[model samples]
Target: MDKSSGTVGVFTAADVAVFSVMLAVSVGIGVYSSYLELRYRSRALRQVITGALLINICIYMSFCLYAPSLALATVTNLSTSASILIVGTICTFYITIGGVRAVVYNDVPQTVLMFLGVLIVVLLVCKETVGAAEVWEAAGEGSRLEFFNMDPSPYVRHTFFSTIVLGAFVMLYWVGVSQAPHQRFISVSTLPTAQG
Candidate 1:
């Protein structure tokens, strides 16, 4: 007997409903914009979409910059809100001045640093423990190593089939439909270069 009502795994029904509405709205906007482009041959709608997307990016980036300060504040016993404000302001200043090219350039170094940090943590964990074999054993015992579950039920989450299907859909949407990737790809000198 489950104690939780209308909640499945990490998401509640309300969460699903909200996301569904958001997805519907996004699809509706995209379809409308495409129709306007095709029928009217007007770039005005496209400009509006671009402006809205830029605003969305700014808000999303602000949150991304602020999130790390929560952990930093907890560790240092400082004010999380102050840290977030400082970090967010600095990020906003750079983003406002440097623009998308700056973002693309920064992403490479940020990705490298993230991977290096993960490697260091893994090395430290292995050093303090019995190593990879023991870690694997523990993970297996905790059912964390079940990577090949091929459950065909839609109700079942994190199954191999669901993971593959969802991952493919997400990748397709992000690469083909999302404005950010579309803009980045087209910003290249030539079509062949962008395709490559």
Candidate 2:
């Protein structure tokens, strides 16, 4: 499908398959690397966290370089897309490497700020648009707030149940094994401090 500016953003079935394969490969790499880290019993967790941060920074830096290059030279859309995809994948790689502690500690303030910003935008949007009563009426009729809809479809992106299940899994994985989360485990001076 083309966007308003006539940019081809939608992919063919083959492209979808390729994207899926790339996603699976990235996930597999993350799982495999984590297993290696655990099995080797090497490197303090903090180093891992720092390394992940550095990796992500590097990935973003590379993209920054590419953006300038794209503007200066003639590059195909496919090349630009691939470069962006590489940056995104490397970002995930950085996260997986940084571990849980890095993710959580880094995210804590950002998450809070994100929620506040989102809430402000939502309130503004609501005030500018229909009033609360109309919003509720629309929601009740499932015009604006349906996930699975009145009827469930197998291929839908996510139902509430599916979201809960996936969210639980993600929570467990990130909280249990992430370096960012693990840092807190090791940070306490003593058991008493930890308890406090």
Candidate 3:
């Protein structure tokens, strides 16, 4: 409870319900994957059943890993302990049983769903405030929308050259060197198959 107001806390009943639902859904997905595994014992079929890499990057970036798990939990209207428990237990189970293949497969859809959630939040915010145009302007009110900053100054944070050119090199280097990407890369047989 909050000391001053005697309010219960950040997470309301609704928040708990939502978080519970999310955890339950993840558990269901895991169970379903297991069912798929048991039903199709063929190694060839299992390889095709799997997915992409580093989807956990979204989680790490969004949830900030161990230290900020509490803060991230609070933001999501979950208690710190509950958040940690849900993520830790569920992920361990999937990865343990399914291995990196499970991680990669799950990451693909989870990343898509994460973005979809963000898009929903954006739409809701726009509805609550003003239209999408106002939201766009508000984003630009800060310099976040400045993608084409052509400044050559090293001190400048987000010059077009720095973001587009340097960021490409960084991405290329990461793709080349990152263990997660390489694992995902080799999971597929051919470039065309992977692309498809």
- State every prediction's TM-score relative to the real structure: 0.65, 0.39, 0.54
Candidate no. 1 TM-score: 0.65
**How should the candidates be ordered by TM-score, best one leading?**
1, 3, 2
Instruction: Give the per-residue lDDT digits (tens) of candidate 1, residues 1-196.
Output: 1244633233344533543443334434333245335433457755675677679778876677667888778788679888887777887799789875676667768999999999999888887899978878888899888778889998887999999999987885565455566444434445554334
Better of 1 and 2 by lDDT: 1
List the global CA lDDT of all models: 0.65, 0.55, 0.59
Positional deviation of 2 in candidate 2, in angstroms? 56
Top candidate, metric lDDT: 1
lDDT of 3 by residue, 131-184 (tens): 989988988897568766789887889787778878876774455333345555
- Between candidates 1 and 3, the TM-score winner: 1
Spell out the clash pairs found in candidate 3. none
Give the per-residue Cα lDDT of candidate 3 at 68.
54
lDDT of 2 by residue, 48-162 (tens): 6557756965776777667755653445555665656765576668768885445545665788898999999878877977876776776779856665543345466677666
Q: List the pairs of residues colliding in candidate 1.
A: none
For candidate 2, the TM-score is: 0.39
RMSD value for candidate 3: 20.8
Give the top-scoring candidate (TM-score): 1
